[model samples]
Target: MKKGILILAGIFAMTFVSCKEDAAKKVKEENVEMAEGRDAKNTDFPVMSFAKTEHDFGTINEGDVVEHKFEFTNTGKAPLVIVSAKGSCGCTVPQWPKDPIAPGAKGEMLVKFNSSGKPNQQTKQVTITANTETGKEIIKIKASVTPKAKPVSGTPVSK
Candidate 1:
């Protein structure tokens, strides 16, 4: 009986030690993962770089739709994510890529400016918000438009 009791106690001690070691290992792994996540959140890198900071669309006629494309490159180590893009007014509309751009990849943003209600020399700006090393990237586009003169009607004369 005495021998059996000693063996059971020994087995229980061994099991407890093994469980404690496993718990410690799990905690260590969790700490490492948390550290990595925090680092990623704080990391910043440029996803794209524009050849020209701004685009200028020459003079355009009223009621005409003017379109332009702004090109850029992923100049960072990580993929580039564009959060959102917005135009200064309703006359200008912008379209951007929905997917993340990998490093060294190329991307573009297409912009269309409607001159239906716009007149005279005009300058517009398109703001792009991105997840990059710089936090946010802003790009501007400008244009000038001339509305066509109304046609003059002549009085009908009897021939």
Candidate 2:
């Protein structure tokens, strides 16, 4: 029984070592690929130049829907392709252009924030994924919401 156990332990150790070596090799190859990609991006990348990074809606009542357009310019050598734009929350939605913008071209994205059920101060972020230098860009929206008062319900008072 002891001999059989030893053989099993040896096989397990060998498999574990082989897997570790394979993982290390894969990591090294991935690192090299990433480095090459970075070099390419450094040489030719799209730059996003926004007129404003943040917008303030001031004070709004609850259930108010507000929207704003953020303008940007592709001030780089390569065309700008926005992969995706995501909002931080469901209440905030962003719409961006699907077509790529040529260098030195202008574009705009519309962001809407629904103030339903959200009261007091609120801040939201929109993350844009693109082939830019940093690969990601962030824009923010802020607002101060005035909550609606709840109505009291009970017996009707005498007129």
Candidate 3:
């Protein structure tokens, strides 16, 4: 029975890998056509490069609002145009540039995470849609929220 189950899993894995390979090949062919009329020196697809893809705030107090700026550059020959950046939830918001980033130029995205009613380890992701080779990218924001310490009934306030 164990051997039969192992064979079934192997077959499933093979099928999944084959499907993934087919999708990758189709994307590659589309990219090749995307660069057809572009500059001779640049590929048809734009390349987006970021200084960092994840940021950790370590530990923050509850009700704190944290902000981070993600720096990125257009390393490809073509201009990088980001269509939209959407956050994972309402408490997490991302602001991206409306203008296109010319090749070799730099841009930034501002992401704010509010820990209003949230606690513990929180992670939020921002999905970016762009005209880059991969067409999409994701950035992560993480933080450990600690609630405010409460005072005992007999405790005296220190002034």
Predicted structure 2, TM vs. truth: 0.77
Task: In candidate 1, list every pair of residues with a backbone clash.
Answer: 45-133
Candidate 3's C-alpha lDDT?
0.90
TM-score of each: 0.66, 0.77, 0.67
Which candidate's lDDT is highest? Answer: 2
lDDT of 3 at 30: 63
For candidate 3, give the lDDT of residue 134.
80
In candidate 2, the residue pairs with backbone N, CA or C atoms under 3 Å apart (3 or more residues apart, or in different chains) clash, namely none
Please list the C-alpha lDDT of all candidates, in the order they appear: 0.83, 0.95, 0.90
List the candidates ranked by lDDT, beginning with the highest.
Answer: 2, 3, 1
The parts of candidate 1 lying over 4 Å away from their true place are 1-44, 151-159
**Candidate 1: residue 54 lDDT (0-100):** 82
lDDT of 3 by residue, 9-52 (tens): 99999888775545565567666777774646555677878999
lDDT of 1 by residue, 75-118 (tens): 88888889888989998898999999999999999988998878
For model 1, what is the alpha-carbon lDDT of residue 4?
100
